[model samples]
Target chain A: MFRHVVLFTWTEETTDEQKATLAAELAKLPGAIPEIRAFTFGPDAGVNPGNQEFAIVADFDNVEDFLVYRDHPVHQAAIAEHIKPIAASRAAAQFVFQA
Target chain B: MFRHVVLFTWTEETTDEQKATLAAELAKLPGAIPEIRAFTFGPDAGVNPGNQEFAIVADFDNVEDFLVYRDHPVHQAAIAEHIKPIAASRAAAQFVFQA
Candidate 1:
């Protein structure tokens, strides 16, 4: 399986309502896109001082499927409408798990 | 369960050998620290241009257990001896999984 992880640091001006909207939009991806095998996302618990405010962990069958999810119109729309405006920074990684 | 995710961008000067060593040392954590419920780490596949070089997703029973693993001597030693030296940047997040 291939895993895609993204950590997002929200801008100071971002409101709680906006954050909830982002999370709701993100949660809709699995149903909206067939390529996503599994999806999990949530607000950071703030136990770690250096942690980003939000995180997503999604799984796909392979890199091809991951790309499909990445470039899907629904995902793109979420980025443009919800994520991009409030996100101050994003850190992402993709990897294949042999086991 | 509580999940701790960390994304790492390695310095340009960091060698592949160093990265491999870091992965190997990280793999030893579950055995060294009983608090760790699950651990996964690997190099990014580079399918995504914005991806960091490496990522880790570790799970624990709760935040307190995650902290035990995070601050354990073995984990701290590995960070000091291996991870800290070569890592250019780090993005992290901690969250609880309800389901």
Candidate 2:
């Protein structure tokens, strides 16, 4: 299996209510994206020293499936409609398991 | 790189202070493991929903390195000393990235 994990930082101006709204919007993408096997997204509690704003873990069948999800129009729309408004910075890593 | 990602849920009674202490303990395992390249851990804000207690991402050179970290005395000691005292349930997944 292959996966892509994303960590996002929201602007300082972002409010809890807005974050909740965006989180709810993002929660809708899993069903819309065909290649995703599993999708998990949640807020980052600063309780940990290296805490950030949010984190995401999504899985796919393989690299191709991952790539499809990475660039899928549905995902792009979701990003444009929901994420772009509040997210400040983001980092992502892709991993594919090999035997 | 390969990684064994562990997701842990502390008992509901687990307090923030104890969780912080445990976080510091687990956070120290990376250096002692020798083979570990990167380690990141934080609390799940749960603001996005599907919330959990904590999530960790640790990277190693390969599967063997991951295994070494998993079973090493230093890691075991840390787990027993820090994690066992508070963690309620745990789930993990290992990934080996392919080129």
Model 1 TM-score (2 dp): 0.95
Model 1's CAPRI class is medium
TM-score of chain B of 2: 0.88
Q: Which ten contiguous residues of candidate 2 chain A have the minimum total lDDT? A: A44-53
CA RMSD, predictions in order = 1.3, 13.9
Each candidate structure's TM-score, on Cα atoms with residue i matched to residue i, is: 0.95, 0.52
Output the lDDT of residue A46, model 1. Answer: 83
lDDT of candidates 1 onward, in order: 0.90, 0.69
After TM-score superposition, the amount by which residue A25's alpha carbon in candidate 2 deviates from its true location, in angstroms, is 20
lDDT of 1 by residue, A1-99 (tens): 898999999899999899989888888999999988878888999887877999998889999999999899999999999999999999999988754
**lDDT, residue B49, candidate 2:** 37
Q: Candidate 1: DockQ?
A: 0.79
